[model samples]
Target: DKKVVLITGCSSGIGLSLAVRLASDPNKTFKVYATMRNLAKKERLLESVKGLHKDTLDILQMDVTDRQSILDARDRVVEKRVDILVCNAGVGLMGPLELQSLDTMRQILEVNLFGTIQTIQAFLPEMKAQGQGRILVTGSTGGLHGLPFNEVYCASKFAIEGACESLAVLLQHFNIHVSLIECGPVNTDFLVNLQKVELGDTSLEQLDTHTLGLYEKYLQHCDSVFQNAAQDTEDIVKVFLDAIQSPSPLFRYFTSGVVPPLTQLKITQPDGSQCIRSMSKIIFSSEEK
Candidate 1:
């Protein structure tokens, strides 16, 4: 019996990569429902899976922020039985917090935090009743560390970190395993989508010079990380495969060498002040030199 695996955010990047990877499995281990916010953007996904494993994959329309879309998507899945649920949908918000509007911030939380919760709520009951299932979320090092301009993004991921950790314990009783795939930079458009300071925006014009300077430096820092050390999508799919296939998978899996040390600082230094200062130097200090 093939596992019915449903993944969100399949329009591009990791979600798309993972979906195609599993769907093309020669053994036919997975019946993949690759979902995204809009069906129109699915052309890329369609192109990737062409002539290969076409029967195993289905691209469905689902907006994580919309509960009805999620419910409708679930209803469309076979038996409504999602043996593995990958909450890969996320949005990025970067830039000076002051420059961001309340509406935009709410949208981030709605998609990244509340959206995840709502998706799980819709499918969790069925998983519980079935007595066994797997839930893998695309967590980030940002969830554990506070980055310079990614305050809201980090907060939303941090909330998910806590939620997944807490739920892992409760779900253990039901033979349902939960894993958070904590990764560093991956070769994806996600970084490209991070907030860029608009030259004509009046809001950014009001920020202090130092804040603006830091924002510029932070963007450079992030770009450097992505350019120099970002892993390919194939690299991350390997970790996902392990988490899904292993007889006993860990609660957290780190996908890149670059992210481990970033997460360790907080653990090694209890106060977390050292961790913050260290990161501050990485993003802000290099500009001095």
Candidate 2:
């Protein structure tokens, strides 16, 4: 029997790479429903799978924020019985928290948190009926700890971490598995595509104008010290594969080399305060040099 997989946010980056990799496997019978917000933007996705096996990859339209799109996608794949569901669609918001708009925060939470919940709701019952399935979510290193200029993005991912943790317990009885992939900074267009939301009349701007100055100084320093810190997309894809295939997969898989050390420090260090303190010193101390 062929396993059916549905992945959201397949227009580019890790989602696109995963879809391509899965399609290349000849032994494992797969029908991959690669989904994105806009079908037109998936030219690259289409092009990547062009020469490979026919009918193995199907590109579908899905906007995580819209219920209608989710329902439509569900209808298309309802017959196949999805064996795996990858909630990979997410947006990043960069800049000081004080400079962020309420709308921006809402949008991030909507897509990264509520959107993931909706996806689980729409698909979990089907998986339960089938008796076995896997759910992989793209969490971030930021979800493990806070980062400057990415409070909203981190908050949304943090929510995902919590949601998936609870989901693991809730779905265990049904023989379904839920896992979170805490990926590091991969060389992707994720940062480039962040949506800019205008902050309305508020004290946030005044606070941002002050903090932005500090952040600008720190960013310049971090950029120099962390020039070689980016992770490869292929490495992340390998971790995703492991998570999906493991006989007894962990509740959380931290994909980056950096994340494990940081997570350990957070756990072992006394009071759990030194982790952030150390990170802050490394991140902001360059300004002094």
Candidate 3:
């Protein structure tokens, strides 16, 4: 039987690349379902692989926030069990924490965390019955560390990490694998789209006047750092492929070069207080100099 893989957020970035790669692999027989929130935006994605591998790729509509949509998509494949499930749909919300509304927080969590879980739940019964399947959730470096202006996005990723951790344990007995891919900033439209949000006058209102003044001075500096930290989306897609195919896959894989050292530092450091003290001194000293 040919293996079937389902991936969300297939319109761009890592998800797009993964769909193309899996469909192109001749050694393995696969049916790749590349799903997106809006199918209309996927024409370029479809065109990119038009003549290359026509039979393997199928574009489907899936919005993580909508239960009915997930069920409908599941119904299409309910008879054909999914060999690998990639929960990759996500969104980014950035700004001063106080300026972020409760609705924004809810929406992020709904899409990034709850949506992934719902997809898993929707597919898990069939996978469990088969006694074999792999589940991969796209987490983030932000999941492991908190960063400025990304509180809501980070919170949602953190929730994903925690949920997947428990899920891995719970599914161990069934021979169903669950892995979290903790990725870094990729070269994608994520950052560009994030900048387009209308912050309004309240963007500055959320901060203390003095803090806002300081932020204005450092905003350019921060943006420069973020722009330079970009990694190739294909690198993340490769990691996802390895996680799916490896005989003994890890429970979690970090795709960014910086994540390993950061993970080590978090473990070796005694507590959050010490880590904060160290980070504060480094950041302040650099600014002062």
Candidate 4:
């Protein structure tokens, strides 16, 4: 019996890599449903897989933000049951909070928070009845700790942490496991895909000079971190595989293999001031602490 897996956001990044990897599994261990909001973008996924493994791979249209689309994709699942569900569809928003439009913020929450929950809601009943299942969420360090310009993005990820943790407590009773794969920067199109306030954008013209300076610094820091530290999507997929294969999978798997030094501050210093200072130093080191 091949494990039936459905992954959201298969147009690129971790989702595409995971889909290709699972479908190409030498043992043919998984039947993968690699879904995306736009099937038009599936050529990259198809190209990556080289048009092989028809039996192991299926593509479907799933716009996580749309309830009907999620249900429609679920109905198309030939197996009628998803043994593994990967909610990897998400977008990022960056800039000073004051400059972020309400609509843009709502869009982030729609896809990152509500969409993930909706997808899980659609599949929960069937998985519960099956007596076993795995739910893997692609989390972020931003969720676990604050970043300079990613307030809303972090909030959405943090919300998922709470949601998944709460569900884990109940799902254990059903022999289902819920895991969050907390990722740091990954070599993906996320930077390109995110909604960002660019330096040259006209909107920045009205912002205070101090904020403009900080935003520039933040962008530089972002580029440096991703250039030096971002992991490949393949690395992230391996952690997903670990969670899927483990008999007793952990509730949270850090792709870096251990807790990050900065993130550990949130745990070690509950007052939060210390963590705030540390993060500030990392991103705005040019300015005085």
The number of the candidate with the highest TM-score is 4
Cα deviation in Å at residue 95, candidate 2?
1.1
lDDT ranking, best first: 4, 1, 2, 3
Clashing residue pairs, backbone N/CA/C < 3 A, model 2: none
Q: Would you estimate the TM-scores of all the predictions?
A: 0.96, 0.90, 0.90, 0.99
> Model 4: residues >4 Å from true position, as ranges?
none
Q: Relative to the true structure, how large is the alpha-carbon lDDT of every model?
A: 0.89, 0.81, 0.78, 0.95
108-169, model 1: which lDDT tens digit per residue? 99999999999999999999999999999999888989887888999999999999999999
lDDT (C-alpha) at residue 69 in model 2: 95
lDDT for model 3: 0.78
- What is candidate 4's CA lDDT for residue 219? 95
Q: Write the per-residue lDDT of candidate 4 for residues 96-162, one digit (tens) a residue.
A: 8989999999999999999999999999999999999999999998889988789999999999999
After superposition, candidate 3 runs with Cα above 4 Å error: 195-202, 213-222, 257-259, 278-289
Between the candidate structures 1 and 4, which one is better when assessed by lDDT?
4
Candidate 4 local Cα displacement, residue 114, angstroms: 0.3
Which ten-residue region of model 4 has the weakest summed lDDT?
Answer: 280-289
Q: Candidate 4 lDDT (Cα, whole model)? A: 0.95
Write the residue-wise lDDT of candidate 2 on 1-289 in tens digits.
6678899999999999999888777675677889999999888987888867566888889999998899899899845588989999999887666566798789999999999899888998889998899999998888988777778888898889998999999899988999998887777778667764323434445764656566665556535644577677789999988987799788888886445676779788857678877777767765433
